[model samples]
Target: MHRTYSLRSTRAPTASQIQNPPPPPSSTKSGRFFGRGGLGHALRRNTAGAFAPDLAKKLSQLVKMEKNVMRSLEMVAKERMDVAQQLSIWGEGCDEDVSDVTDKLGVLIYEIGELEDQYVDRYDQYRITMKSIRNIEASVQPSRDRKQKITDQIAHLKYKEPNSPKIVVLEQELVRAEAESLVAEAQLSNITREKIKAAYSYQFDALREHCEKVAIIAGYGKHLLELIDDTPVTPGETRAAYDGYEASKAIIQDCEDALTNWVSQNAAVSAKLSVRSRQLSQRRRNNIKRRSEQGVGHDLSSQDAPLNDEVSWESTGQQQDEYDDAEEEEDDETEPSKHSMLLNGDGSNGEKRGRSQEAVAA
Candidate 1:
């Protein structure tokens, strides 16, 4: 015993059978029986000999037809399977893209934060430099004023310093004034006034350079973010890509939809094939029954009843119902539930699959 529908023929078609082929059996509305008139006509119209060669030719043609339909069904099932494989590959690719973009966004965020910290740090440095410059000026201003006053007083004392007591005291006061001026100069040197001036120039240059560099990088990153946000995603708009992230996402969704539809279509065709197999079984049985009633005991057991012992006709309807139930259950559990026609294998973004949670999180 083998599968219920075996299109194999024991004998090859003769040249006469090829030239004048008989008609195949017609299916009935009940789906279990064939059109009696068609089968009986094929069997009775032959008058060549005792052996119904014409009837045999008709049965061969029927088998050929079944084989052709079965081949077509198998081809469709294969196509549907190819679509599923492509869907899985496309989905994994999209996941990679989403992950890549997510990583890039994270890097951008971290870089921006570093730039902000640099900006604050640079500003603090600039502020401290300015404060040191102000403090140095405040410390040196009084000494500079005092030195100018002593020069003026010594000019007047030089004219009266020979013998008068007031002249001697004024001269001594002038000497003390000169020494105080020298002391103030030494104190100013201790403060490293020249070094502070040099620091002012160099620090400002370094800070400006650092700040400008950080600003440029931060600006560039911000511009990139804006571009991503501003890109038009609506259909019928311009096409673009940010490292192909958006395009890949759209493709993944389209593939998912196509796979779902193809799978559903495969299920439908499988059901049809099952029905067709049953029809072929019933037609063969009818022919055998008629032959037996006429006392022509032609053996069709090998051709008609070749299914596995575990398989029974009683469960055919139940099996189909179960297949349909399983299909519905699978649709509920998977993501591509919405119905769609698989027009082509190309993953075109002509339609939108609703935003997925993973896409949103990324």
Candidate 2:
């Protein structure tokens, strides 16, 4: 019952803690009918899309589903900690070596639970970011509805009273509605892209950190296991006196230090894309850059001069072809240098070359 490695503290409650008391910890038991989530989760998920505006319905359900995921993670973290405590309790009646190893293992498992809890907090950040997107989607729905309603009214009047004076007024209103809808739609598009990128980036970084830390804990757990004497013994042959206390404590300390010092900069795992994936990613980035540049130029040119429709179309096509050709040439020039760097294993040369190429491009 000596819980030396437990994460709980015995200090008095802080002012903030006293003012805003934390909720009681949830039981490990699942609910009677609806499983761990109980009735609320099911109700929220089933009703999420029904009450949402048409434009935001799918996204609304997605947000609700993410909430369910977070709840499940919370349950899992709690259960993991419970399992760790159970492991330590179960090991108490065993022989010394087994008892010591299991207790240390419980410590590592409990740390994983703590890490999972922290991950849940960080994941809430991603969920909150996604909520921004859902809010924007909901706001944009009204403008879309207004535009459609106006258009329908205009069509009905044109059919019933072809020459009515109200038709002109409706047309003007329709134009205004269309403008507002356009602005709203643009805002939605921009915010959706921005928030989606940010939200997923946060989630992925958190996932990577959590996974790496768990792996580190597993590695040290293996070292602790090596201290156990798993060798078979003859009948009634008592094992040697338990003497791995210092070594086990050192391993635990080392693990704690490693966890404390762990940072994203020193992350040991990396994702390497295949050649085709890299090429596709590069092409996608290049296309987005070129299109953005072209859009700015097109906007400026339109403001400066009014060109004939046919002439503008032809010039735009020609400009697009020129951009494609230039991009191809740049890719060709960079590919050889990239390959050489990979072969030589000299990242500094690649960095210098990249800087020079960027300077030339500028």
Q: For model 2, how many clashes?
A: 0
Model 2 per-residue lDDT tens digits across residues 1-362:
23344323222443323443422322211122333376647865776656556776787778767767876887787677667767877887789898878887877887797678667777877877886787667656666776788799889988999998998998987777776666666667667778899999878987887899899999999999999999999999999999987787778777876776677777899999999999999999999899998884222211221222355335644644453343223113322322123225352211221111111111
Candidate 2 residue-wise lDDT at 209: 79
* Range of the 10 consecutive residues with the lowest summed lDDT in candidate 1: 1-10
What's each prediction's clash count?
1, 0
User: Model 1, residue 258: displacement in angstroms?
Assistant: 42
Candidate 2 local Cα displacement, residue 197, angstroms: 0.2
Distance from true location, Cα of 179 in model 1, Å: 2.7
lDDT of 1 by residue, 186-244 (tens): 54454445445664554454344334443444444343344343444687775443364
